[model samples]
Target chain A: MDQRLNAKDFEDALPCDAPDSGPLRWAPPEAPLAMQKQVLETRTSWADLALVGRLFLSRRKA
Target chain B: MHSHLSPDRPTRLCRLLALSFSLIAAITASLLMAEAAARDGFGALDGARAALIFLTTAWLAWGASLALIGAPGLQRRRAQPDLRMPQPRTVILIPICNEDPLTTFARIAAIDASVAEAGVTADIAVLSDTRDEAAARRERFAFARLLRETGGEGRIFYRRRTQNVGRKAGNIEDFFRRSGSAYDLAVILDADSLMSGEAIRTMIARMQEDPKLGLLQTLPRIIGARSLFGRALQFAAGFHGPVFSRGLARMQGATGPFWGHNAIVRVRAFAGSCGLPELSGKPPFGGHILSHDYVEAALLARGGWKVEVDPSIAGSYEEGPDNVLSFARRDRRWCQGNLQHSRLLLAPGLASWSRFVFLQNIAAYVVSTLWAAFLVASFVATVTAPPPNYFPEAHQLYPVFPNTSTREITMLVFGVVGLLIIPKLTILTGAIASNRVQGFGGVIRATSSVLAEIVLTTLLAPLMLLYHSRAVLQVLSGQDGGWPANQRGEGLLGLADGWRSGRWIVLVGATALTTVYWIAPDLLIWLLPVGLPMLAAPFLIAWTSRPLTHALFRVPEEIASPPVVATYHEVCARWEMTWKNSPAEPSAGMAVEHHVPA
Candidate 1:
């Protein structure tokens, strides 16, 4: 029963993203929010062993 | 012998025979002197007798050593293992200074294509020391474009130095720092170095089999020798030099020379021990060790790694210096670097094998200086001293003063002649026996080329001796032989500069010989084999780069052609394709570009 960490949980741990935080902002507001969220989700899925199995199967067939 | 001589040519043949005999007589005289000197005193001889005796003895010993090494019996024993196998992943490093990028890139591309066709996995890196940003950018762009077009983008990498701290050594060190950990082994190549893909595969297989072995240095056969000077050197290196190197290998046992390139070294061993030490003194003999190979070999040996020279490995190649001035410039640095080994000879904690090598390095300089002095002293003594009487004064303890016996003299003549000619005969025999004769223009051309090479070598020997002697003097006088990047193309002789640089030895030897000749015509005639060549240097230099001579002789074709590589390529190609298809990291593409076809 190993605990799994999601992207939202990781981002929330950062001090700059906290609700009370001020005077510290590195990210630009105009950046594509949907693309960024998709990228994070894709990265999170890669950490799963099932994804590795699928990738190997695809490579062998190719 | 008499029946073969024509009436007109009898005298010429006789002179040749006499010259042969005199060389032997000179050697015997020296040996007898050494024997006598050892019993009573060597110091008792007048300076002239001493010098003549020493020079003759040194030449005789060296010649005899060469003869022994080239003996058929020795040749049969010097066979290498037939360890040919499929190629392994190879990293080829071409270390360059501010050389022409176009020529360098073209050569690299040619090698790349050859390797690719052979199907060998190769990583090529052009390690450049050009500090100028513009020049660096130009090379980078050229390399990038070449790689892209050739489909070698991931296999070729070009990096320039921000700081050229240690020259060639520093450039290589930087590469090792970045990417050395990735490759199996690195083939350190000079800009002028070019080896066949098959030869590379053979070297790789040999390395793969012998994991304990650290390096395998191939004897580079000279190619592209367009100039007369270059051609002569090419001939000597291809024909006579191998026998001497075989002898050196025999004597060196485990501790052999690493001649920088045309060789392979284990990556880990090189990284661990090849970091050179900064000398505590000034330039010429000190500062950053100019000739790092010798010291690197020593360091490798000290670290319990084996460094050996395999002269039998074929197809390793390099270009010779185009002319006399270019050669002198190169020799000047070599002289200083070799002289610097004197300090290492005294260093402690080194293995006995390494110490012996260090001694040999130092002796390379010392012996040259000694021979130079001996040459001068011989002439001075011959002039001032009275001639030797045929009959000697009797001593109370001995019945007669020991003089050279007629029997000994005859034996000496045969021995000296055997020493000079037997090595060439052995090489000819080896060429035939090995069936390498078929590759060249068969037996006839090989035999004729060998004969021509001997005559040319004999003429050039004295000139080289004179040049080396001057280098020795320059090193001893504390004049720094400024390090120049090796000259690539042919050019006219800078006559005034050449004269200024070489005048000391030339003037000294010419004046001494002239004075000696005036006093003793017999001695002068006896010394003509050596004297005539030195006197003919200016003419030799002027004609050294003549195109007509090169074309007529077929000198380039005789020496420069790569050995047959069909079977070697087949084996390597099979291995490389198999490796590529296997699951591996995404190809970085840096490794194959150095060998891409131009």
Candidate 2:
């Protein structure tokens, strides 16, 4: 239903700036190549995906 | 805003008119049909028989429509995914008035363990209204020790109000005012609530998903329903309760129900919108809101926030009353609280959907009254009407005698089947699909348990109906059925007290059925629908435990495993321990602490 947020829009909404200073990092390296491709193709925001991905990773570590 | 009820007034008037018209139509149709039957030399006996069939069919149709619409509405609402996520910092408030501290502490510890396992960091506040300095100190120290033992040292804290103020709501508000700014959300828990890790995580995620979501309530399954009556209640709740709630959810959507405990709310939402308005009255409907959950949900909805029930969510549990009287005691307070919502039905700005939910609550009360009336009517008809004809005067009376329409019979059969069987089938399906049947010693044992539960519930139904009827009468008459804090013990009822409270229903039902049977021997078969259940009440109540029922059923050893019995046993043990450890003295000092200042 709703439009997927873009990187710039997500960045503006973030409480703090990202540590990365590159042009724009859009996909996680550890994600499967197909998933990464879909992320890029779908215009999924990096921040929103990163937050969920990070939470999952933390859960696994715990 | 000018006081205007124009929009709602017209709708309310229309609804009343529709109800009146339908009732009048039903009466007219039945009377005319009876009159026509009488004129055809079909004697008064035949007319009475025709009337009975028509009335029964009408009752079945009414019940079916309610189930079809109401059940789906509840289900659809519960199906919505919770969107709230975990905030970094939050407060979990557990309000205790005069409850057992150890029991409360153990449950909190269980919840604390579950939350930590979910990796959600939050502070715990034990808001005690116990005034005694010594007892309060003891409870606080016990909580502190339990927290540290469980690796939650700084995260767990305690607070006691010097003054009780406005009871539970005030106790929470006091905390919010003092330390409200420190947390983004608050999890309000009852002293008895036991939530699992996954449930907590899901609830937090739901809150995170929707910022405007004020509350997320989980349907609580009964925990310690050990007695026969209690077990029947447990099975009913664990089985049929979800279907009815799932139906309610479908109708209410986001603005469903808030059942007080086992739910989470946003801090800002609580502070801004959930402050309860005191009613100008006395006991039963007044003082403080006895049942605050529904009113809180209404307030949250009024303040433009979503409040919902999620029945699919699991591991939120509460205990059921062990016997009929205990249930009546609890229901008396509930009846008053729900009846109070009659006023809220007309409150301004509520979504029409929420008002519908309020109406459904009232409908539940109405059903009790209607059923009682039907029982009385059936008794009167049995006494006054003559026996059925041995040889029908109109075997060829085509449309007049209309060979008991298959549609009506099927509708009646299906309604009974759906209410009794479908719920168990649903749970069995869920368990099988999830592969959680391992705990119950495979398929056969689980099936037997379902069968046992059905028989147990059937026998106990008459008793419950009678208890609820008395409760309805008390509520209607405005009697103060004071809060009989739930009995958490294994103390069996004294036989005399049990008979005094329980035997009257059985006597009345049995007496009516016996009268029907004596007058018309052929009617004996139909009387099973009412008679057998009443006769089995005492036996059912006596053998309601898992161990006892299993033994009585001669369940196979493979199915009646130690683990299954142990689960029930542990519940009993906990209740007994709670009772045995109650404070020795009146604890007058503690009483003073919980006394709310007028």
Candidate 3:
């Protein structure tokens, strides 16, 4: 729709999919979570432990 | 109000502003740290610290700019729905996974009754993915009890799957695979979700009016909080959430957010676009998509459907975790889901903003880990740093310590703190100016609530950093935090429970503090804000989990409960008594508030 489509345009094409049409529209790339031991441990949990803290407001999860 | 989003929302301008603010913040942080480090010859450690500080600061500034950009629309009035348009053929979907039966059913009953009163013609479906046979049996019994109460035999449906293949997403997919074609739209909600007829009506009208609008999400106000932690969260959602959401809306003009529950989706569009593909392998990254909502939003955007959020609708409500332990446990699962989304950042055919949203979601979780990394670098840099060269010249006696960096460091501290807080203070000011604080128990009480929320959240931030960091590690190591049932009505935890959950956290705090004191005592003050809280986390966790009865963090819902919220509790109360008084055999007419069709 280009996001250029407006609610006022009722004449626009309205295409619908079959209920059983199951070709997945999206797929994952290779395991992006897979990371090097050095990076994971250092970035998230250093050689021994990671010191983590900083207050910035955001709750993309919630 | 979520969307004043037009095709001409000036999103490019907002993006430019966001970019400029982030760059400025990042450069400023880097330069300030470099200036401090320059007093002693800057080492590799100093360089590492500067880079980490730059990245995290930029991320923080990006979040701040959303508030700045969206603050103006806080008090803007929403357009009324056209009542004359015929209500669309809709089905209200309540997806549950091993949730408590009576309570979950009670919420459904309230929604059903509300929709009925609103004169909306819709079928209600209780789509249960409960794998436990006993819980599934209880759901059926409670569903029958619900049917008897509402007298909605055929119009309401309850179905449970033998195998919960894709979890909640799969559960909804099962619905579409069976009866999706009969409805024009589907209102998807979680077990904890409840919406007023006004909110429901507004979403439906918006969808009906806009054919290309695939999904419309509403900002559900948190309610029914009995504990201090939950109440504080409720206040934040009611107060700060709107402005942030407005910023989100302004940034995301057409391709908006879909937060799993409390959203309406056009059946054809969703069925066409959101068939999530399991990744090529096993747990964590290579399996059923855990954060299906965001992906679905992205997919719809890919398919050219306008996804949006309407924050103006007032009656949407959901319950938050009443305590810290429950919140963190839930966060563990969400953290994994969000991490899994990093795979889709490069997915084919996604809208630009959609890809950015994925990036943003991953960044939200990853930023904590990055900040932690910055702290580690700073710690090592400070401890390993050589003694300052007091006499850089050939002359021996003259010491050369510069004090200019102290003032710059102070200014940097205030700048970072201001970036974190000024947006919220501005929102409160806007509220007071717009008389928005009237619903929050007047300006004094509302101001108190914001201040209290700030203090409580600041204390809890360290704990979240640890939790989030651990979660990222677990996911990276291919650990799957399985789908666990959400703990409702269970926020109370003993000090022992807190200790059991956070004992390692205590060790971490102790180690950092002790190490800083031993190796770099001068930097101890910098670490105390975070480290001290970690040390006392057990006590904070246990204490905050306890129930409270005060008006400090009072939200509007506390002042005047919505009709749907009132109805939910009423239905739950009546159903509970009837359920307790009647026989356990549900099919043998265990309880009936009204005559149910045989």
Most accurate candidate by DockQ: 3
Instruction: Please write out the lDDT profile of model 3 over residues B1-598, one tens digit for every residue.
Output: 1232234537777878888999999999999998887766788888887888888889889989988888865334568665445667788898888687777898889888898888777888888887766566667667656765676766777887778888998888877877776777889988889987767887888887788899999998888787789889888988999888888887787889999999999988888888777776788887888888999998888777899876777788888888888888888888888888877777776777887888888888888899899889878876777766668789678787855467767777888888888888999998998899998889999998898888998999999999889988898998888887777877678999889988988999999999999988988998999999999999889989877775677777767777788888888777667665544523221122321110
- lDDT of residue B559 for candidate 1: 38
Candidate 2 residue-wise lDDT, B194-293, digit = tens = 7765677777777887777788888887654445666556655654566556645544556768887778888777777766666656756555666667
Ranking by lDDT: 3, 1, 2
The TM-score obtained by model 2 is 0.67
**Per-model lDDT:** 0.61, 0.58, 0.78
Worst 10 residues of 1 chain B by lDDT: B589-598
User: DockQ, per-model, please?
Assistant: 0.01, 0.01, 0.01
Tens-place lDDT digits, model 1, residues B48-103: 45455545444555544544554444653443433344455578999888664544
Q: Which ten-residue region of model 3 chain B has the weakest summed lDDT?
A: B589-598
Better of 2 and 3 by DockQ: 3
Candidate 2 displacement at residue B341 in angstroms: 1.8
Q: How many backbone clashes does candidate 1 have?
A: 16
Using lDDT as the measure, name the better of candidate 2 and candidate 3. Answer: 3
